[model samples]
Target: MTGRIHRTAAGLGPAAPVRAVHLGLGGFHRSHQAWYTAGDPEWGIAAYTFRNTELPRALTEQQGVYTLLVAGEEAEVVGSLSRAHAGADRESWLADLASPDVAVLTLTVTEAAYAVPEPGQDSAVQRVVAGLRARHRSGGAPITVVPCDNVPDNGAVLRSVLRSATRDDRRFAAWVEEQVSVVSTVVDRITPAPTDEDVAAALRATGLRDEAPVRTEPFTEWLLAGDFPAGRPAWERRGARFVPDVGVYQQRKLWFLNGAHSLLAYAGLARGHTTIREAVDDDALAGTVQQWWDTAARHIALDPAEVAEYCRRLRDRFAAPGIRHQLRQIATDGSQKIPARWLPVLRAERAAGRLPGAVVTGLAAWLLHLRGGEVRDPRAAELVESAGSVRRALLALDEEVGADDELVSAVEAELHRT
Candidate 1:
């Protein structure tokens, strides 16, 4: 246990059978889904990462067991991640998907990953389609696809990706129509990008020199809609809720929690704050977050008390100094995140004849953030290279936001606040 100990050598917990396959093997997936799966002894995840090969290599070396650093204190070793592999391990990927034993395939790469794969790039969704197609030829067993990203109707979106990808393959496409049940999920957990202290903390908390420790907040939630046809882990045992519909629940989360987060990430970074704790604790930024929440709360279909409680809890979570959720990390992929988390609020408020001040402010912060040149989006060249292309950049997020002169003016007005 002294130098880079493996899970077997550490004897943390027994690894479960690999009954699940997860794309995007990252900290969020580890802290959230795999953490729940860690509780369910029946299933384990054979997770893969195409982009970050180093992760799979590290996890594989560590025997797919990593410490879950909750609140930067307690380090519980999660062993449900039974196997880790790279996306290029397509043979294994196809085998897992084709096998009737692997019943559920979940993904959380990011909204940017859902875009059509570039030339020679294998997107996560494309890999899923390929796997499912293979499953069809291998005596297709009913499998469930649960999309755990922030995309609205994530399940339907993934389903569309599958359908569009397999349109020429008539037999496989029909098999998909019958065999796949894409489940939409609303997942919440604040898993910051790991810091250098994480490795040291894991070693201190668990007598093991771990490399891939997942540091996350104490708060977590998972609400799902749709059936697990072949079978799935009893995720409910680990506080996961399976509901008839996750539509309203998703909106509440996307508009309120994620929307506020986008605001904080941009505005906080602009204000020279580094982490969520610093940003949320700042009086001015805190007030802006509250305003954004109030604006979104007007549209969320949840009870006022419930929304208030959720916001209260969010403040507590955000204020936890231990969380250390980085504003810059959250700031990445602003183009994708803005459309998902802020566009609805912007459009709704404008249509209601009330301009969303906080939304405008967040947009201004984001545009300025773009011009500051730390942007990590697919459209980085067009949007971030020059400051004069404000309309082009705004249009990239939404046509309405781009076209509305008043909204554009409001954002421009806020941009001058500095």
Candidate 2:
């Protein structure tokens, strides 16, 4: 059968449904959340990119439609998004939030965007508070805010930020605390940035070029533990789990999967591998990742059975032949990722009087990569400016470094040596 593409209001067809709002309008959002919404038109998403008008412009031009190619080990499962739009229409984006049709507010603001204020804040949370306050003043119904960043206490962090910003505004804050629902979530999907060639291939697959095509692995998971303030997608109907606790799930993904991904990102970049598939295919680096996962696994609280299952899924996803997820992309924002991804496990190891060797090595690689000496990922330059001296960075971030000597020495020693 010849592959063909279609454009509709929602992206797939005119009859496709729409609802919901997402903040970070990026490729991963398209492949994962939008793809899920497309599976069931009843849940369409209104999305806005952060500080950039590019995605909104392209998406608008494409008629708010794009292809979702679920590239597997070799094949692809293609779909379309009909309900997505760039925040080029800010009024429209907020209107949906104020409308009865949109209930859930999902975010993919990446780690850095969440770093509004310094160590504590110089009114850092004010912006988020103002945003929410405006939405509240918009006279909209209550809404649930789900943050998909890698922050440990994501919902609490965002809520605190919002509250701190609005603390002076008693009336608005009270309304928010009572009416808004903040949901903590753990999202896993190794969707990579598509290269020029990959974009060409996606277009070739459909015999039509799409300006905003997204490529991702077949695996995806969303674990939530909070109330949907106003309401939410029947995401559970599509395999999204609303668990009583997302802590174990969060740790499992953060410490092992993300930890290992970070390790390989720096280590692999030092070895000159560009994409994740290339890094995993390298036996030495893949072995390092497995070893890191092994060491980090001991700290996670999930059932050993589920932990093993997650590892299998991660391996398959990383091995995805068609997804060219760049190592550099994952390697971005180490300053923010280190605290949430590596520091907690190190603290746990110290508390238990155990040495997390794999995690230590991963940290060492990050330190080395951040020191601006080994890794070739140019983006690392600006991302880890604080890495020049871990001591100052940690102190500045107010991060409790339990294994001070070991951690610092490990990272410093590997700085030039590694």
- Every candidate's lDDT: 0.86, 0.69
Q: Which residue pairs in model 2 clash with each other?
A: 10-82, 10-83, 11-82, 19-44, 56-86
| All candidates: CA RMSD (Å) | 1.6, 4.0
Model 2 residue runs over 4 Å out of place are 1-11, 15-18, 73-89, 115-128, 373-399
- Which digits, one per residue and each the tens of the lDDT, describe model 2 over residues 171-283? 88898898788888898887777667765766666666666777777778888999875666676666888899888778888887788788788788878898888888999
Report backbone clashes per prediction. 0, 5
Candidate 1 yields a Cα-based lDDT of 0.86
For residues 1-418, what per-residue lDDT tens digits would candidate 1 score against the true structure?
2877576667766678889999988999999999998878889899988867888999988988888999846678888888999878999999999989999998988988776554465778678878988888899999999889999888888888778777877988898998899999999999999888999999988888888998998889999999888988989888999998999988988888888888999999999998888998899999999998998888878899999998998888889877888888888888888888988887788889999888888988898898887788877887776445666668777877788888877777787776
What is candidate 2's local distance difference test score? Answer: 0.69
Give the TM-scores of the predictions, in the order they appear: 0.96, 0.86
What is the lDDT for 122 in model 2?
A: 24
Weakest ten-residue segment in model 2 by summed lDDT:
73-82
